[model samples]
Target: MSAGEQHGGRVTIRQVAVHAGVSEAAVSYALNGRPGVSEQTRARVLAAARELGWAPNIAARSLGTARANAVGMVLVRPPRVMVVDSFFTQMLSGVEAELNRAEVALVLHLVDAFEQTIDVYRRWYAGRAVDGVILTDLRHDDPRPAALRDIGLPGALIGGGPDDFDLCGLSSVDADVAGTARGILGYLRALRHRDVARVAGPADLLHTAQRDAAYAAAADDLGDLRYRVVHTNYSAADGMRATRELLSTAGPPTALVFDNDVMAAAALRVAHEMGLAVPADFSVVAWDDSDLCQITVPEITAMVQTPALQAELTARALLRALAGGEPTHVVLPAGTLTARGSTRPPKRLG
Candidate 1:
């Protein structure tokens, strides 16, 4: 029987090599697009393989290539937050959708500390369990990017900005956080809210710093504005606490901005408990438009970040890095502010 009919049509590399009158190594180099084979030899081997219907063994190919066909993602977040937060769930969904198209697997690990997250990276590298990693929750002066470089592992950062592109020579995916912050300030100003308070996330987070700086700059540009920012852990309980303190202060802000939907929902409860009518006594704004934001008594006005699209872009950037491409910085369009029933001109600006 001809090489084409060998092993019931499951032609092997050896059969292709024999048919082309070349070494099996030459066939392999040619098939893998490596440099060992000359152009003429490569052409002949390719033709022979096609004629013989030779199909590569994926497992063998991966072993020879030292490729895991998988990527790792280590998140330094509380397990409780990850389970209850739709932001992370949507992010994972988007990342998985793109990776699925490339036939790649995702290894996800959630930890309470940054050190443990780094340890997971080291272990993953030693075991050759992943081709690269995806980083999230970028922090100020973060060390993980440098650590990945030291480990000789490729990675991409999510929530990066233009200024962060050169961080540890890694790829990055970002949104226009600064612009969004300024836009929110302007929108609130237009609603005649002169004194506003922002209940922000962790102060150490890079995005938080960016938003804080932007808010300060915008507030300065808009003269006669009074604003204060309270740092929290992006939790509902913290949100209620911060809101209660700000509302009970001697000179309370007429408007409150929360870093997340859960926090804004908590603020709504605090307002109710304090006998303050939303948008009449105070206004509420949230950063991410989640389901909770929509179902509140007075639907919350929010900044809309398309988490799915951002995560997909992040996955794509990491995949490109794995393919020997130069590190890329992808910045999606700035998030838009969606107004709902939760905001209006303050009765009397403080």
Candidate 2:
């Protein structure tokens, strides 16, 4: 037999299968570190391949060196909102800056439906269209993290919470969202605002949930604190609607904290039309400290969680995983409260 044939033709997958005492499919799964095969079987397959000096045939393997050298992201929002959202655009710029350094491309796909988002990931993985992926806007009981791991895909989840850790090949980076809410509430309370309101984003988001729970706890601590929360879809119109509802109430809030700068900006307009005086009749604080917070008549107080910096951190996490680093969870510093012109002590109403 020729040396190649004697050595099982330079170690085919079938030979590795026979040597590891596993099925060919298991060998394939094991070789790729897929979820189906047990760790023992995976190790055995790897050991057998190593002993036989069987290097991967990049031309034949799905996850070979001839990769796309790109990262994938699927955003679940309308195109107009994405275009207008300073946070998303700013975060994308940060993600791009980090990715550009390594000559890696960012392949962004926008999907409105949840099912479509999952399909995008599946397509990207099957086609080997990206070396890794970045996930954002994490929701409660999100399934994408696990789905990526099961398919042996590498990804970094941004804005995920504490419960998002420890998937097989998934990494995560998140700021302390709850702590941010606490700081906001604390600031409002210090202003002697007894009636405070929070205009929050979607209830299904994990980050929103964290903030919601923290808001509740802080309100509880401040005895005699009358608080209300209006959930919106992160739209300007929704912000206007929620703001109008609160202002029309018999006991309107003296201070308001909005989920994003867009909503906060919208609140300013609605407040003006309702004949409410800024920092006199009411106060406004936004979660994100975007440019929108500053350009208005009175600058908005904000919880300054730098979106660009956060996105850069998340991209670094994805790069680390792609370079063979073990998956890890990174916790970022909580956002800081920046006092501005839009908030003041509530006026005493007899």
* Top-scoring candidate (lDDT): 1
Question: How many Å off is the CA of 292 in candidate 1?
Answer: 1.3
- State the lDDT of candidate 2 residue by residue for 82-148, as single tens digits: 3458887788998998888666889999888766877888899888888888988777677887788
Clash totals for all candidate models: 0, 0
The runs of at least 3 residues in candidate 2 whose Cα sits more than 4 Å from the true structure, single-residue gaps closed, are 1-64, 79-83, 162-169
| Each candidate: RMSD | 6.4, 10.2
**132-222 in candidate 1: lDDT tens per residue?**
9988887767788889999999998777843633478788788888777788889999988899999999897888887888788889988
Sliding window of 10 residues with minimal summed lDDT for model 2: 1-10
- lDDT of all the models against the reference? 0.84, 0.81
